[model samples]
Target: MDQKKEIKKTNDQIINSFSTELQTKVKTSISIIEEAVARYGYEGLSLSYNGGKDCLIILDLIHSIATGILPTNLTNPEKLKEIVLFYLRDEDDFEEIDEFVNTSLRSYDFRNYTKFATNSLKQGLIYILKEYPKLQGIFLGTRTADLKGRKQPIFAPTNGDWPESIRISPIMEWNYSDIWDYLLTKKVSYCELYDQGYTSLGLKSQTKQNPLLKQKNGEFLPAWVLSQKSSERDGRILSLSNSSTSTQIH
Candidate 1:
């Protein structure tokens, strides 16, 4: 099939698939997390929440489902427990975002990594897990469609450096619209970036305004908009599931 035709087919699928996948992903995520906690007998699990809209949604679902198993729901805005919420930002801007995640959030672990690149979020998590080996599993809000590098996805058995604690992503199949709809329905509080024109939210420097919000061709783009030659992708550092992995193109 031609590349253009494939894009069209996927775009059409995003509409119906968005809602269907959103619910499915949430349920799937819940089941996986519960199973891990039940089998491993963990008191709590850690999440690398980036203070974005999708992260907020993941926190909500985790709180709702994992409460039964772990008895430690970090995402619950009401319980106000101290679960770690990690931030990767420049030293200059850390104060404000830290305050927001702390004061605004009812419960959090409240960890920050300054001087390290945002890509270090993964490495930081690895370090934390290594230090505190009791943590059974980890959760993230990464969806397949959000990252261009993750088109055809494998839900189970996702590989990572921190393999001891099985990695779980509840919203793995959700589309952008599905995220928004779920947020609206659940009334979860998220960062205000989504309302402002930004499609993919990340560090202040790395994030870009959505190209497709105003144009048809711009939607569903990966969060990182900077284009580089394929050769350069190798040198770039990327983070996923609280672990840093090299992007080596063969």
Candidate 2:
């Protein structure tokens, strides 16, 4: 089949598998992207993608809309160099994530392309803005399940100390179960670490598979099986995570 047909097929499969509530959520998220692109005109907007599960969903929606499966009235760039991309790549992050991001970077063309992070997420934001000075906003994959994202509004400005930019979280209302439901049901490709029982990802040295997923067979279940939302970060060394928020999560 041709590319457009294939994209439509994939999109249909994804949408059909979602529950009615989730279907609305997905469409709302798509509309959020449409609104952002309409307001920012793609070039003025940026995508804060880092090969995480949430961002994977964000990217998929963007692809579908851009390809006309979801239909944005605006002219879809045959390639989505329309909106820019940025990621805060740290040397200490997981190799699997970096590999996935690199592979995606090649296809999506969203990199200002830096591999560094200071002691804080705010500093990372500062650097991203400095690199992409013209960007008015960025689409973040942040969800309520993430501690930093719990209180965040769907649309908000950066904190006073952080560099100024609008942070658009399309999936802000989605819960833990909602996330896994969408990813698995859509058959979206995600980072391999998730299959290894990692519910949440942090720096490679500090993060591990969720302890709560351990089974009687000396093996552990995947991230999707973790019963408690609060225990998602049980594998991470909290002290370091408290100091520096991870790029892997968003």
Candidate 3:
């Protein structure tokens, strides 16, 4: 099979793997995305990709939609040619995460769509917006359980004083387990940190293996084994506390 046909086959497998119930939800999310793209055009939309589990799910969803696995009103092939993918690269990011992001971009044929900024999230976003003023929307992978994500709508309009871009959270209703299920079922490659007990990812200095996942047999469990969604960020907070004390002592 040719590369294009192989890619399409992979996407079809992923989309078909979803349960009937999940498929319904996926369709709804895709519809929301299609509407947004229709309203602003593909050039006017961006995907906020962070190389995290949630963002990975969003990435796959977009791929499925673009390949026509999920329904979409977009008919122009040119609109899909240069769909912008934005990433804010922190200096303290994990090496594994960086590697995964690069590998996935190529593996998923998204190398041409990526835009990287080595600055703080806010600054990176501002820079991108300034560079691409036509961009009016960003597709985020924020779930309701994430920090400051509870109130975000599936199609949130931008604040008047903000960057003048809508923040779209199609998977806002999805939970922790939902994310893992989708990724694993789709045979998606994720950051290696998850296998090392890191439930949630952040700057390397502010993230660590989840202590709760340590077993009495001196073995570590994968992040997806985590039962509580709220505790996913415990490692991050613990790391921050340690960093703060180390700073004070110096």
Candidate 4:
């Protein structure tokens, strides 16, 4: 199948797999996004994607909503064409994540709308906003369980000289299990690092296979195999400490 057809098929499958309750939540989220698009115009909005599972879910939601499959009253189909996507490529990023991002861009036909930069996320956003002065909002995949994500509202206005844009977190209420369920049920492809036990991803120097999922034969299980939410970030933290120690020794 062609890329567009494959993308539509995947989105249709995701919409079909939504449970009744999830369907309601998804509709509400779509409405929120549609309203934002209407108020700000697509040219004034952007998506902050990090090639993570949560961001992938948000992308799916946006696609479904924009294609009129989520039961929203949004009428501007062309609006989707104007909203740009930004990805911050860390210097030490995992190669698997980079591959996944490239695949997703082709599958979703976002090659023209996506921008990638190796600088800090803040700097990248600043550059984009400067290029498009009308940009007033950015959609994010931040969940409440994340450290800086706790207590974030669905729509948050920024302060200071950083861009005068609103931060939108549509999936802030979702948990780790909710994300996994949606991704698995939708048959969406994710970064290969997850299958190698990297639950919470970061730079390669700050991420490692989850020790809890390590087998006696020395093979590591997938991140989804972890039974506890508290252990999700264990591998990242451990890797950070290891890197710190190595730096001190050198």
- State every prediction's TM-score relative to the real structure: 0.59, 0.83, 0.82, 0.82
**lDDT per residue as tens, model 3, 131-211:** 788888888776676634236577777664556678787887777777787878777889888998988887776677788
lDDT of 1 by residue, 1-250 (tens): 9965765565344333436655466556556655545544443456655566556666666554433322222244223133334444444332434455555454523332222334454565566566556755555666664455645332333355534554556676666566667666555555554454555444444444554433465444332222332211222233323322311110
Provide the clash count, candidate 3: 0
Over all chains combined, what TM-score does candidate 4 have? Answer: 0.82
For each predicted model, how many residue pairs clash, with residues at least 3 apart or on different chains? 7, 0, 0, 0
Best by lDDT: 2
Predicted model with the maximum TM-score: 2
List the global CA lDDT of all models.
Answer: 0.47, 0.72, 0.70, 0.70
Residue-level lDDT of model 4, residues 50-142, one tens digit each, is 778878887877766666544456677645755788777766777777788878877776533545455355566677787777888888776
After TM-score superposition, the amount by which residue 239's alpha carbon in candidate 3 deviates from its true location, in angstroms, is 10
Scored against the true structure, residue 32 in model 2 reaches a CA lDDT of 83
Clashing pairs in 4: none
Candidate 2 accuracy as lDDT? 0.72
- Model 4 alpha-carbon miss at residue 63, Å: 1.4
For residue 2, model 2's alpha carbon misses the true position, in angstroms, by 15
